[model samples]
Target chain A: MAKKRILIAKPGLDGHDRGAKYVARALKDAGYEVIYTGIRQTPEAIVSTAIQEDVDFIGLSLLSGAHNELFPRVVELLDNKGAEDIIVFGGGVIPIDDFDYLKSKGVKAIFTPGAQIKDIIDFIELQN
Target chain B: MSLNEIIAKKFSSWEKNVLEKLLKKFPERQKEFLTASSEKVERLYLPFENEQEKYIRDLGFPGEFPFTRGIQPTMFRGRLWTMRQYAGFGTAEESNQRYKFLLSQGQTGLSIAFDLPTQIGYDSDHPMSEGEVGKVGVAIDSLKDMEILFDGIPLDKVSTSMTINAPASVLLAMYIAVGEKQGVPREKLQGTIQNDILKEYVARGTYIFPPEPSMRLITNIFEYCSGELKNFNTISISGYHIREAGSTAVQEVAFTLSNGIEYVKAAVNAGLDVDSFAGRLSFFFNAHNDLFEEVAKFRAARRIWAKIMRDKFSAKNEKSLLLRFHTQTGGSTLTAQQPDNNIVRVAIQTLAAVLGGTQSLHTNSRDEALALPTEDSVRIALRTQQIVGYESGVTNTVDPLGGSYFVESLTDSIESEAQTYISKIESLGGMISAIEKGFIQKEIQDSAYKYQKDIESNERIVVGVNKFSVEEKPPKGLLRVDPKLRDLQIKKTTEVKKNRNNEKVKKNLSALKVASSDPNANLMPFIVDAVKEYATLGEICSVLRETFGEYKENIVL
Candidate 1:
């Protein structure tokens, strides 16, 4: 099977792209094609990239501790654009209960720290 | 058959049979690289090197004056370092759920990661916030979201660490309010707000106002937290972001310490006593893959900080000199390929943090390189900490890596190299001047480029990436965020705005603007007043920006 194309974008005031870069590397290593949008990206830029790239997944990495207001916005945009199947996911510091909430909100899997990559890979497989 | 011939024959036989036999397989053996990762190995030490090395001079006992070996003598024997894995993702409600889950899982502390919108003081409903709300962390615009973010989670029980810089005072104020509603007294609250705004100019980029006002805001937090929230750490002068920004281990130490020094100067200038709030000062550092180098960096950091507080600042209290820090494993080191390899990496990094004597730790999830860690992943990460703490016997001794000739030498060298950097920054008129001239920024860029070049050139091998190619395809089915979060959050934010007391928000916002314009004002009190009145984060930050001004980074890279 062909590897899924995933775009890892760092949007808004977050300039820390290290997490996204590592995620892109992991995805690519997992045989997925990864596109990295460098730091200071606006939300519009991320959605446009996700749409234009026709990626199978969009992974956002937030170290800025601002996910409560950031992650849902991306998902909402994805839905409004009629691209809900894009398999968007993200990684960061989050409490476990929030993971269930996000998963319920259509976040397929919420990975806190020490997440199993195989589990993530498996998750994407089922989605694809 | 003479005696000489007999001895020669025996020696020749021994050489051929034993040494030559092993040498025969030399061609098949892998070559060993002699050089260490971060610093040159100190081959031989002279007595002169230890000339000034006294128990009081070089190595102080834990919790004693000029603490270097450990922050406290008992260390984990007294109480284990807090296991604080920072977390937040998606809307306030979403992240709030995560916080509660983590708390249930025996996570002793809560460190909140703010999303972009909230970090730079934008409400989730703002145009700039857009699809970025809660993408990387929890988003909080007003008291509504803050209240929701902490919903059901007893703030009185858990210590919260907010990793917000430009808007730290605001987030902290919100947290205080959350505690207030939770029936927790302000005096009883314990937590840290990473109010080290100087680092925003140096490393992390979540800053909103310019440097001068930013410094003033930091001093304001110091003054307020000093008296109001005595248990709360006013600033966590951090090196985590510096290392995350791709600086070398030494640079992380140097820049972070220098930033700490600058904060102290600011606090002192504001007429605050060093000892009154010094014990509450905390630090955050990164534990990278370079085990020995990281260990040395921590030791060096403690010693250097002790001296700074004692000699430089003339601090009398020992707690004012000791550096208590929180260590988070470097996300930069985790590889996407051979994802399981990240487990080993995290293990090593966590071990290093433990060895370095961290007061608290947050281990990065292995699958984080793929997505936000799932429950399974977070548990694994927490397990990683538990295994290290319980199973690993490394913590039995304080600074287990200490006393080695090599480690001591490396610590000395790191200290000297860091001092050189401090001097260089000193030459340029301190960190702010260096920041203004883009000196530190340029150095990080150069180092990052060099490291990248080394990787590209195959000089630095990242296993399973540049090397050890696997033929089999990676396993499929990764975690993914849903498509509906955006609309839900937007609707929630819109509803909040529509239903909230806008007139009250306007009144509080104007008060915030007035307070922000005054140099002597403590922004945290006004931020608390604003949050209590439901003023959005954007409204608060906008006033600061308008009054102080926005700074465009002088990007050199």
Candidate 2:
């Protein structure tokens, strides 16, 4: 199978990109092609980029506590664009309390701080 | 025999007789021990023969030139560090209550945390600020919010530190206006504005203008503060965000001091005397998990900065050479799992900061990794500092670990390594050009990746994360900002606009635009004029963004 392509993006004004860049680089090392959009990306820009890249997964990283609004908006935009198959995962300083709600809104998984890169790769592999 | 020969003979004999036998049966846990920065650590540190000369040159007494031991003569024996917790969130009124609570709880100073909208220079109602108003910190749209944020607090009595960049001038102007309202003169106000913008390009991403204009704004503050606000620190050259962005301890010191050098050079080139402003140039650093490494990083930082001031800039005033800094426990080190474990981690980091001679300190709350800390968690964090300050007995003496062989060696190692990185940056034509070329960002990212890989492979053990794992119920009662906060903040800003005089606002803003265009004109007075007219932060920053184009980041993977 061809390598799984992923779009790693930051969808808000919070510039804590340490986790996002780390995950993006880790996925690439695990034989996945990752396209990372730098900080301050809007949901529209992120959705358009994911569509342009034709990635298998869209990993949204937000540390600004705006994840509840921004994460769901990204998932909703993908649905409107008929790209719902593009798996949407979220990460960063996300509280576990919101995990179920995010999952209900179509974010397949939520990676909080202290999550290992291997666990992320395992999640992606299980999707296969 | 001389001291060198005598110690060398004794050390070799001890190593052969004791260490050799022990290592044969019980090998060390790993092939080599390394610090958090991946620097090699030897089995033991022994004093060398040239100690007397080296001590006099490098480890002089506290409060002297090359302030390696500490900056003040008496150190904590004279005064304990200011226990300033960085706290702010929700609307100005809500945050004001939190500040009063903290002050009543014995916090010595105030460190305001601005929300994302205020940090990036957007009003609460901007499209870009959707879902972000008053989320991470307090949202301030105009002078009205500033007044409420410090409503009962006296400006002259309590020192304030604002973690703001990009729109720092606007915020500083608002602070001045607030002081004026409180019947305090600008010269009487004490505190710092985090006006360092180079780090924003390198690590934190809150930058507004390109490099040339940003440097100009920083110098503008230095020049303005030198005569106008004498008690205020013009800029806080920070390595905290850089370290949080995943650079090692060495990079933290190196890049931060390099940025400091850039700012000093900019001030001098802008025709401001170094002595006038360099004394007020404060520093902010991160206190990470490694006790010795973190301690040595601080010591090394002071020595390096002292040398830079004396040798590089030819600064004559002793105060200009002192590296007074505030430290905060590392946010990146806190683990979301086993939240209670973070208290212990913060306790250790607090000791390191105190031992490192920090002028002030902020301890991270245990629940920060999960959410904004609750009042309970914030109290515990503050108490952690108090316990160490009063009970730990580490503050009884100055630079208690100054002469330890291991600590001195590590301090030396860190300083030399940091100097090497500084030289490389200098070769790359200073910090701004190096940042423009993405050199600093690339270095930090590489270190961050390596650190993550170490955690993944279990080479590094983050207790409760990789090892000693536990399964527990999800956390409860983490502070949550109401989603309706955005609406309330927008309403507040709308009301402020309605009540303020519109004609004066436009006139001051236009004058600011013209002042911003002139290279020699200081923009501080112009900013203050606009701020006094109740012009919003977003409005002031918009004018600057129009005059000086926004910075496009160099995306380096």
Candidate 3:
């Protein structure tokens, strides 16, 4: 199979990117093409990067407690552009109550900290 | 036989008879064990085998020269480490309530966490600040918001530490103006600004202007504080964010001290005497999980800083040689899987920080890995420190772990490794050049990568992560900031801008713009004047952006 293109983008002002980079590297090592837009990316920048990179999945990471506003905004932006199939997934310092709310808003999956990299890979494979 | 020879002989026989026998039956857990700093741990530490001569030279009594044991002679017995919790979120009014609550609960100091917009020098109303205002911390746009934030708090009585960078000058200027309003003279102001911007380039990503102008702004604060706010710590040379950004304990020490070196150099080059400002110089560090390693890191930091001040810069004042630091238990260590386990993790880290002799401390809450800590969680975090202070019995003596054979060795090891890193930065033409070359970022990325790999591979076991995790119901009751805060803050900023005398604000900002280009001119007075005129932080910093320009990071990965 051709390598699945994935864009690991940080959407918001949170500079803590260890998780995002870690997932990107893991995806790359698992034979996926990964494009990581660096920190402080806005929703528009993230959506535009997804469209430009033509990625199969968008892995959004945020830790600054701006996940509720920024993460859904990315999904909503993708939906407005008819790029809903881009498969938005995310992980951050998100509360449990927000998980169903996020999933209902088109976030395909949500991973919290201490989540295994392999589980993320499995989640992506299931989506495909 | 000599005492050293006899001890060596006994250790050899014990290894063969006891250690080897146990290993043969049950097998060793791993081929080798390493600390968080990648230092190999010996199975046993013997007196003659360790560095005795170096210990006598380096690990002198508490409050003595070099200050390896502790800075104060009495340590905690004189007064306990100030239990300061880093708190802020939503509107200024809400955050002020939280501060008052903490103070009532026995918090000795106040540490404010600013929102992303405020931290990056943007007013809450700015288009770029949409969806981010008051999400992570309190949003302040003008003196109005700052005035409300400290509404009832006496400025001179409480020590405040604001974790703001890039826009540190604006915040400090506003603070001085607030102090003036409160009938507290500038000299009576006690606070610290996280003005260390080089780390923003190396670790954190909230940098506004480039390194050159950032250093200029920092030196301006140093000079201003030296002349006026004598009790205020102009800049907190911080490693808390560095460690949170995924650096080893050694890198945390080395890079933090290296950044400190750059600031001192810049201030001295700005024609300020080192001793005049260095006495009020404070440090912020992260206390991680490893008990001895964390303790050793603190000791090493103090010793190295003392040597640098006394020898390298020839600082005459004894206070200049004293490295007073505040520590926060590592936030990155909090595990979301077993949120309750984080309490124990914080306790261990808090003990390490106390034993390490931190002047002030903040213990991370259990639910922080999920969201901003709620009132209950914050109280528990504060109680963890109190239990250690009142009940733990470890505080009765200073540097209780001082003469441990293992601790002394680890202290020396970390100090030497950190010195090597400083030397490398010096060779690369100091921290700015090294950061521009992406050397420092690459080092941190590499360290973070290795650490994550170790956790992933179970080489380093984080309990409830790789080891003892049980299926947990998702954590509930995590604190959530009100979404309407964005609009409220924007409205507040709009009102301030509309009501302030436009011509005066305009003239003061333009003067600030003119002064931004001059190397010799101190910009603090101009910033303070503009802040007094109710000029928004964005307006003042926008002038600087036009003059010095924003910094773009050269991300290595």
List ranges where model 1 is wrong by over 4 Å.
A1-11, A17-128, B1-37, B42-56, B472-477
lDDT by residue for model 2 over B1-557, one digit each (tens)? 98889889988999899989999999999998989878899988999559999999999999997889999999999999999999999999999999999999999999999999999999999999988888889999999999999999999999999999889989999999999999999899999999989999978899989989999999998988888999998889999999999999999999999999999999999988889999999999999999999999999999999999999999999999989999999999999999999999999999999999999999999999999999999999999999999999999999999999999999999999999999999999999989988899999999999998888889999999999998989999999999999999999889999999999999999999999899999999999999999999999999999999999979999
Please write out the lDDT profile of model 2 over residues A35-70, one tens digit for every residue. 999999999999999999999999999998999999
Note the Cα lDDT for every prediction shown: 0.78, 0.94, 0.90
Q: Write the per-residue lDDT of candidate 3 for residues B412-524, one digit (tens) a residue.
A: 88999999999999999999999999888888878888888889998899999999989888777778888888888888888888888999999999999889888889999
Model 2, docking class: high
Any idea how many clashes model 1 has?
73
Better of 1 and 3 by lDDT: 3
lDDT of 3 by residue, A1-128 (tens): 88889999988777788888778877888899999998888899999999988899999998887777888999999999889889999998778788888888888898888888888999989976
Q: What are the TM-scores, per candidate, against the unseen true structure?
A: 0.79, 0.99, 0.97
* lDDT per residue as tens, model 1, B265-367: 8789888898887888899999988787888889899999988899989899877988999999998787666777888889989988998899999999877
DockQ of each: 0.16, 0.84, 0.69
Which candidate number has the best lDDT? 2
Q: Residue B270's C-alpha lDDT in candidate 2?
A: 90
User: How many Å off is the CA of B299 in candidate 3?
Assistant: 0.6
Rank order (by DockQ, best first): 2, 3, 1
Ranked by TM-score from best down, the candidates are 2, 3, 1
